[model samples]
Target: MGIFTRSIVSRKPNESMRLIVTTFFGVVFGFLIGLCFPKLSLTKFSLSTSILTAIDFKYTEYTKLGPSSSTHVSHPVGNNGSSANVTLRKIWVPSNPRGAERLPPGIVRAESDLYLRRLWGKPSEDLTSKPKYLVTFTVGYDQRKNIDAAVKKFSGNFTILLFHYDGRTTEWDEFEWSKKAIHVSVRRQTKWWYAKRFLHPDIVATYDYIFIWDEDLGVEHFNAEEYIKLVKKHGLEISQPGLEPNKGLTWQMTKRRGDREVHKETEEKAGWCNHPHVPPCAAFVEIMAPVFSRDAWRCVWHMIQNDLVHGWGLDFALRKCVEPAHEKIGVVDSQWIVHQSVPSLGNQGESLDGKAPWKGVRERCKKEWSIFQTRFSRAEKAYLKEINSTSR
Candidate 1:
């Protein structure tokens, strides 16, 4: 202490003042740096170098990326044989104009439904009851009696949706249930067309299961509540009530079995099935009465071709939507419906070159089946090629 005092006394007045000012500023600068990075110690030279490097990196990244964007960094080799930087930025999902990154996961509004909401009621109290399941039928006015009977088979828990191909929506109002039901009217359009447009996965996501059915089905022997019970009991994600063995039965797998509650497989004609797990023999249901669990429908909705409205070959490929599909897809034997096989939609087609409208419709169905199979095969091949290359 005595030596420092003597040294300060020996120095010129201006020099002493300069040393005091320099020391004071140096201490203040270090204290401010400490406040900025409390975790980084200034005493350790190695740690200080690391801290400076990190600060430089953050400054460069923030300046380059800017606000309103998030990035995922990846390292890939460039054509010049040097490591290149890749930035994956946020993108807005079509359903949300605000961008998906800003929202919580799974909180998307892409799903919607046919439930009627009142303008005067609070949003939470709008619906007296939220239906757990959905049932849809494509109808012409001629099938009103059958559809009326069919709707009765489903309990109050099911949301009834009717697609009118004959443009007679108001006529269905005669039935008491129609007052509560959702009706979509479009002349000469098929069920698949309505399904693609109206029954979007997001729209029907609230329902536990969905029934896409033919209007001509005789549901006298079928009970939807019981059908849902059997579906859940068997862990069936994709299923249908068994088609009555007596009429309109195309595949043996879907034929009603009297002995069992549910059946997942059937014996097919020789060479009809390459494996027991394949379609026709197993994992199969006719489109007319196919019922899908919510998760299964999401996948199936995407597989429906927009242009191929007939939905002829969809039954064969539906197994793609559910894992271990043979087990997950089955027919509930306890609840069976008779397919009336009415050609109402086919009759809507215009007669061409003196050919019957129905015949042309049948031809179109066959053509669509061929096109779907070819497209599916090509897609599988392309996906496999991409996967193989990625693995390499």
Candidate 2:
């Protein structure tokens, strides 16, 4: 009788244990099977594809909130709401969802070959990872050689974007890498316009660094990989390649020095004193070839005023992006580029009435300086006032 009771109890526990083990294995096996032959209709909210294939997904996630929505802008200032003053500038929406045929002005549709689904460039990952660098150039037909040299140096490590203000897209067809690049060909658009229209900070958030380079930089002394190595080592958030000294040198701080990999301070030349807030000796780099880190570009893009196409007054205010900007911004000397100083964009554009194209641009630049000062002053005052209020 005792043996019978013991056997019965032992058998009950053994059955329970076996049941648990079987259940666990069954669930795991089912999950794996689901992944290999996943339901095609499964969405972001669906058990995320059983966690097997989910980990290696190459496509962008369409979240519960959905893919990013298109931008809709309404002009309230105009009588017919068709025209706008400076306050209501052009309405530009750069990105659209896949299969979206309607698009904003100046937003070119990528050729079928350049679609995001089929695109390949620096990331190496199959559209799963962010690019480390996004290099941009404003070029003309005459600047092809310099642009080619730059593309060759950076294309493997960065996603190269070429903005042709001269309006010819096929000129670079001979270069094999041209097919790999994201090219925007719009006639007479300024560098700033291309940036405002296409390279919006949000659109380029996947990139870690943004290099807004001019077309005429001589890159013989520069290596893109070496420059990046120095940038990472020195912890620079906004930087540029040191310009070759005596090659139409514009600023003391930008001059290449043989002794250093990077420089934050520069000595004042004989006749000029380095102003505390002035550039080339402070946190500023000339727009000719400025490189911006991801976070820094966000702040810089917001500060870009509408109607300021020349971007003349921007370098002075670039400090607004990164705190202690002088320390965070520097010129890399170990890998530097020579500025050819070719005025490619100078001769083209719609000029002011009775004014030459270059002259009209000059006037606009001077006017933008005043506008920038006003905006900066007001912004600083508001910021300080808010800080003081919060501290109390």
Candidate 3:
């Protein structure tokens, strides 16, 4: 081997051999250099990836934040010579968070309510007890006596809200309970109009149940606490106190059944119902004194059309919000109320085209009902079409 090596060394190499030797050594040197410095790239890359993953996890995990809470995060960015300790702050903010950070958590992000607060008391001392239910009456001064009677039936567990359509809110303060009641004075508006504006789901979220009632109803035979108990026991999410069968009752479904405590379905006129479980035959209640569970109100509130103030067709469509509507929607027959059916709101309308005020108002109610039906039908069709397309 020494002799062979000596012979090769003695021989002069060609230009191609020199070039080949240089190329081979160059390739090997580059590979060694790469292996030596691999840790710089691999270690930095893995560290950065881990840091980024941790930051991402924090962002998703801390979706809700208390007023005093914060996340302190530090991440090194860029290369070693120009690296920076990047402080990333993902502050919790409301949807419109321009100045929300400085406000109290309750004022900024908590569920709202209509509780009357004292001007002088500490914030926490404003309410002695938080009511579990909300009862709203769209009333006029003419029906104050009736409203007073109705309010008496509900206990302190309810928050009394009066929508004075006649613009006489202060007058209601004569009653002892009215001092604590929340009154909204908006003239010449229907109960549905008041409800849509003031009874937003967010505003009433604290209440377990919400009663949107007309002022004409008489609560002589009804007990609000008992009604709540019966509805809960029967698993009724949407319900109304049954109407006295004798007093100009429009539908048999709403008429009080003396034999039963609560009724889920009623036999309507022949061909009145499309199916036995559908509205009028079942899952039906008149809107006069309808009560809604918090969850049910969320859905029902969305269905109340902004333009259709009379709420003519809303009762029928309420079943859409609840599942097994026949089982979940019903009437508490034992806690029945008398529907006085006073045409007071109709008098609020102005005479138009030689028509009486009430006549014009009734006409609008009927017209709104037709418009609502058409809108509902179209909305259903559009929804079905979109669903079909997406499914395909």
Candidate 4:
């Protein structure tokens, strides 16, 4: 009985050993399967390590390296891609009795003869199919002394729109000396009103090309014929020559917020360069010397608000009409005329002590600018809509 009991105990021990061996082999087999087929594994250690390594390497390259550190593209045409083309027809000036007397009669006669010949020339006839360009000017009392000079400078088929703003008799008599020039005198009651209303209209329709210039802005070293040729080549709607003020004007620079001292210094040194797109469009001045096509003048005249108190908003008003339509406005290579630098209605206000008549004018201009912006925005929207609809 003792021997049988001992044998039973030994058999139990062997069964226990067999169970332990089976469990160990089973665990090993499961581990090998997991390594061979990653999708079966719960830990996912090997796959995770590979994905992490790839991400880290990709980020390292992208964050630390690439092209496009120092390159710039140039755009010669304006953002809207327009070019200026202009043709010169007849040049017009305005003057008074005094201005006429100051000018030389001989010079006036010479100019008149030259202009008559040019007007009768084949080229002028071919361009306008008309014999004359009704070049006209307004004359003030102070302008009589330079009448001859003015006449000599602007030799063309001419008309003289005389304005005797000053209370004086015999003013019309002064212009009688030039038989080639037509003269009309305005009464004091209607001087300003008439001058502003009809200043350029009569001749505007008479000529395909028109130049409205101050009497004092005389032409020197210029051939109107050559200028006309160049303008025709470019096909500009409005054109002006380079205007150099007799005196230099300084431009001011101001600092912007968050700009470093170094950047500010650089900008100051650079001043303002020509705009990438429109070379001569930005910050341009000199209303005294612009030449306009018949089309441009018509556009401007129609676009001008009747309520515009005076000619103070002419530049800004014209820009609004042209820029959006992608019309060409340009400066010519020729230095055509010398402006006398006379102050007009808007300039009456700028004083050293700040008491200027133009404060109201400035405010009006600001309001007008705002209105222009709104109008342009609406126009742009309309244009885009038309383009989209057409494309579809």
Best by TM-score: 3
* CA deviation > 4 Å runs, candidate 1: 1-110
lDDT of 2 by residue, 116-226 (tens): 444565645556534578899988878787788878888465888899988788878888988877889898877887888787776888777889988889998888888
C-alpha-based local distance difference test score of model 1: 0.87
The alpha-carbon deviation from the true structure for residue 328 of candidate 3, after best TM-score superposition, in angstroms, is 0.3
lDDT string for model 4 (170-227, tens) is 6546554455444455543222243346544433565656665554545564455556
Q: lDDT by residue for model 1 over 55-86, one digit each (tens)?
A: 64454343223334656553434456464455
| Native-referenced Cα lDDT, model 4 | 0.47
Top candidate, metric lDDT: 3
What lDDT score goes with residue 27 in model 3? 100
In model 1, residue pairs whose N, Cα or C atoms come closer than 3 Å (at least 3 residues apart or on different chains), thus clashing, are 111-202, 111-203, 112-202, 112-203
TM-score of every candidate: 0.75, 0.65, 0.76, 0.45
Per-model lDDT: 0.87, 0.76, 0.87, 0.47
How should the candidates be ordered by lDDT, best one leading?
A: 3, 1, 2, 4
Candidate number with the higher lDDT (2 or 3)? 3
**Worst-scoring 10-residue span by lDDT in model 1:** 59-68
